[model samples]
Target chain A: MHADYLWTAAPLIVSAPMAKVAMPKLAAAVSKAGGLGFIAAGYHSDHLEDLLQEAEDLLQEGTAETPIKVEEGTPKFLPVGVGFITWSASLEKALPSFSRYCPAAVWLFAPPQGFRDLIPWATRIREATACRTKIWVQVGSVSDAVEVVEAIDPDVIVVQGLDAGGHSLARGASIISLVPEIKDKLQELRPFPQKQIDVFAAGGISDSRGVAAAVALGAHGCVLGTRFLASPESLVAHGYQKALLDASDGGTSTVRTKIYDKVRDIHGWPEGYDGRGLINRTFIDHLNGLSEVKNREMYREELKRGDEGYGVNGRLTTYAGTGVGLIREVIPAGDIVKSLREGARALLYGPHNVSKL
Target chain B: MHADYLWTAAPLIVSAPMAKVAMPKLAAAVSKAGGLGFIAAGYHSDHLEDLLQEAEDLLQEGTAETPIKVEEGTPKFLPVGVGFITWSASLEKALPSFSRYCPAAVWLFAPPQGFRDLIPWATRIREATACRTKIWVQVGSVSDAVEVVEAIDPDVIVVQGLDAGGHSLARGASIISLVPEIKDKLQELRPFPQKQIDVFAAGGISDSRGVAAAVALGAHGCVLGTRFLASPESLVAHGYQKALLDASDGGTSTVRTKIYDKVRDIHGWPEGYDGRGLINRTFIDHLNGLSEVKNREMYREELKRGDEGYGVNGRLTTYAGTGVGLIREVIPAGDIVKSLREGARALLYGPHNVSKL
Candidate 1:
């Protein structure tokens, strides 16, 4: 039941669970390249059985890019790590399918409404799966994190900063400020040797320096979402990837708001949660919360006109962190793992000149 | 014309040119510790001569806490660097007083208005004072940077990120993103051997990690504003400093808006500029921009009832960066410089574990 993959994952890197972006190929590639890779299990509660079945198939017949290699010295790529939005109907629908498939780790994002019952749900997952999956809960604030840890006592807690791409929970605090703040808060707790809790910093981190910075800031590791969005193995449409490269830095194009989600009709996300993406004409027009008759209809037309991330109206949602400016070209998932490892290693142990990486 | 301070200021730390907060004692302490410390020459346009005279006395007599030391193998702590808010009536009012003291560097903050003629003004300073001061121009955007560098050819260009405490020029970008963004923008220029411009990252950077992070982000150095404001030598009132400490992490207390400046009745600042500080009852009550008469009087009455950085109605305006939370305790100014230098050096060149610092 003890998942050795948690400590065995080399480079201490983890691919973020991005909905509609992280696919099996990307997850497999990251795992093969010696980092923990996750399959974003949000947004598709109905298709949980099919997705798990596909994961089983994908595990058997490895892709052309990279196969899951759990060799000696190499990290033991646990069964696919799946993340679910806590309040989503995904849990109820997928409850039947989860017992059949063993996940290396299961990450749960607690919503504000049902957050109190999160521990019960986590208990269910652990009980249902015979405690095979290591539980990781993501928290946005100092207070929420302490509460969750006390209740569920999960294996890992991700301290999500405000600069995170979608649904940041950090109130107004940044990663540089939030990580230490959370660590300081966590330090006050009495020793819990029975449960070892590792903390990960998530947000605008895009490169090797970010990895080093986060580690220095007391995070056991870092979870990067935006960087993985640009990986080739991601499920994003080709056109969307092109748009990401076009709006690479994202300073001029990106704005954080709930408008994109409103236009897309992606409901059920909790309040206080918002998305950061390339600002489009539709977003600009409908930023004040879309009205059903006038603006929503106009937005539907704009959405239908585009197959790529962009239409004539502008860009579709491409959720990204503020560090989007650091991304240059879309590379393979394995390459992302490799480059991040090399870069972090260089900054942490190599010469002082990190820019050369 | 050759200022060794620019190249030889070891550790590459700068006490920010914070008006009212930075005084002779603070500047001298930073300089004594082998970093560039600047006396803010904004707001008090008419008193430049007296300030320069004070700087002369402060340089000679020094403070009991820390004294200016020009030791061998260390920076000479050049003629105290003085910064002026470019549009302030200070220039016209203090032109006669400028030539009386030869400052090591005259840093000019480019005002949004009349920014075009900043070069001519620099030329006039060079002509009148016979080029005794190395001119430094602070720029906000990439386009503004290109224009300024081409026109004035300043010795340094500080990429002011949006997280800077005071008025910042960065267009919706944080320092982690903007420093590299500006560096990339500057790469397009052909060799301007006559004047090579060094870039400094300024904004939310709160600690030694920020120093290492900035250097890794392609900055020649990093400028700290909020961190320095907490120094024992800062001119902030005891009550205001208490408020700053209470609002320390800055997340709960601070909001970036022009309303604070408007309330303070501080004028001569350009349009598009705003202040970031601890939000008080005044900001919450009159967030829609203070209407005249009644509210202004209430705010004035509220401002008077404070000693340290706090008042009965919360805080007046504690200008702060997003990293205000990083400050744990107020120590001497030289200690900040020493700690930042040691911490950054450890992270950059020493072992990977930096949290021990």
Candidate 2:
């Protein structure tokens, strides 16, 4: 079946499941606006039930209309998806939640044993949910996409480039090249007239222009992390939001490094994966040969400052992609999705459309 | 004037002036196929007259139907453009050729003193060509585009991202983010109803999908470097072509480094600029702690082997972007341009167009 059947939107827009940041409100708001929203289950399953329940309650309250397309006779499941840092999250711990609330999809990323490690998680989740939930795997390099597809035959593949925020392969091309390459390779492997696997472009995408561009790059949809960070529904601190707003040339202002994870003592990320964030004192100090212990101490001090600790001078981590510069102000999550969809539609199909070649 | 007036194509396509590789034949072939083409002037003015003369002869012979549109009352000038490695190519040495041929455009890149260094070169070229030659400046960052625009008010700005092959800023985002960011910033500076500066995307663009994506990302056009390398008209060696064809997953097989320049003894590139090329024993050996002298010695030995020296195991450089994996065959440059144009047209305007959002 065409993977687009899983979503109701024409150009599927997805809010990335940024750990601790993407929560029930953000997830539900996106789904309410005709896009897919995901909750970051993170490395622990302790809070997944509560998050899903909150999303369910929000959906039931009918605060906003949802556009999620549920197949006839399908079992009850949350419209929102759940993501995990597969390297640190245990499948056993997450299986209970998967059995309870079969999210529309399960996004697996950064497995320690490479894509093969995701096979078990995908299989168990399928079994637990009776295949109700779709399997989505994120990959940076084409090899990873190939490997993952061969192993799990995932329903969706999110091709994330090096310009992405949080963690990704340290070495990978951008979506301009990566998306089409992966799409072509997958098409060759599966050929046409087979069960088509949907491809979503992620990283460095902040607005409608990016969504339209990703669609032109042969992606069926787009996953946005940094853009959603500017939404009120996201569980981001005020200071972090301000930093993202104040940031202007993110290509230079942001960098990919393990310093944020190191200072936070989050060491379980597999090799070749590093987080992209604003270049601040923590990173500068690390570059200047400051000891890890001293950096950590400063970071702890900044953390106590609450909203004040996440600017250019602040030591707190402000995870963002290179597209952070495009984010101007905080808006409602539903508005972000609606605006992107309308803007992309105009740009792609308007009278002045330049994409007509 | 809108930059589209400078060429005759819809969804304007341009062949990148890859030094030593992009010759008159390739440039003329692209122009013949209804797109703009550029001849790389390299770092010297010695053979410019001969190159321009040969391109003129080719156009006259009409081996291919020329589609380059010439404006009424425009001074006699070659339809193709010329590019310079601004840091090393002296304006005085190149002015004679510029005055004689009065090329359609002059593309400037990698000036040592930054974009300001291009001021004199642009001024003199305009003076020599009586302001007929359009100016195109290549930049890798948003700041650089802003700086160059403020300095020269170029007719076109080529936004080269980090995924580009050949020399470019070592630190920059991919075109997925860079193109629209530059486009927005330039619009903010120039506003609407002002002389609109056309923005073209360069980097990791191999096929029609990339062109469509660039247009969707707000770029007025696209510049293809690696894709053209697979064309028969490119000055690439047989071994280099073979390696490019054999290469898959270019994001992992290629790397950006100054080691190629270091080994070749071509050190004129300014700070923050580096070249991306296929990784081989030369780079591997250097990574393994091989001394510069030892690496150079091995490079010299490999150079003697001619075409045999350019492969995964060989030490010779094969400059290509991250889209190398998509280039499978060596076709005629005209065919490449036509195919890309038609394919992009189909993808962007076909009945199955998914970019409609």
On lDDT, the candidate that comes out on top is 2
How do the residues B227-249 of candidate 2 rate in per-residue lDDT, one tens digit apiece? 99999899999999999999988
lDDT of 1 by residue, A114-161 (tens): 456687668887876777677888877666677777788788888776
Best by DockQ: 2
What are the lDDT scores of the predictions, listed in order?
Answer: 0.68, 0.85
Residue A253 alpha-carbon offset, candidate 2, angstroms? 1.2
- Of candidate 1 chain B, the 10-residue stretch with the lowest lDDT total is B69-78
Model 1 Cα displacement at B26 (Å)?
A: 1.2
lDDT of 2 by residue, A65-128 (tens): 5545433233458888999988887788888877777788999988897788888998899999
Q: Compute the lDDT of residue A102 as modeled in candidate 1.
A: 63
* RMSD of candidate 2 to true structure, Å: 2.3
lDDT of 1 by residue, B1-357 (tens): 224463234457888878877877787777767677788887656777777667666667544543343322222223567888887645666566556666667778856474576866688767656765678788765666777877877778887766677776423556555566667667767444655577887877778877776776667777888888878899987776666566644454466777667667776577557777777776777756567455666767866576732642653667777777677778888889888877877776665554332
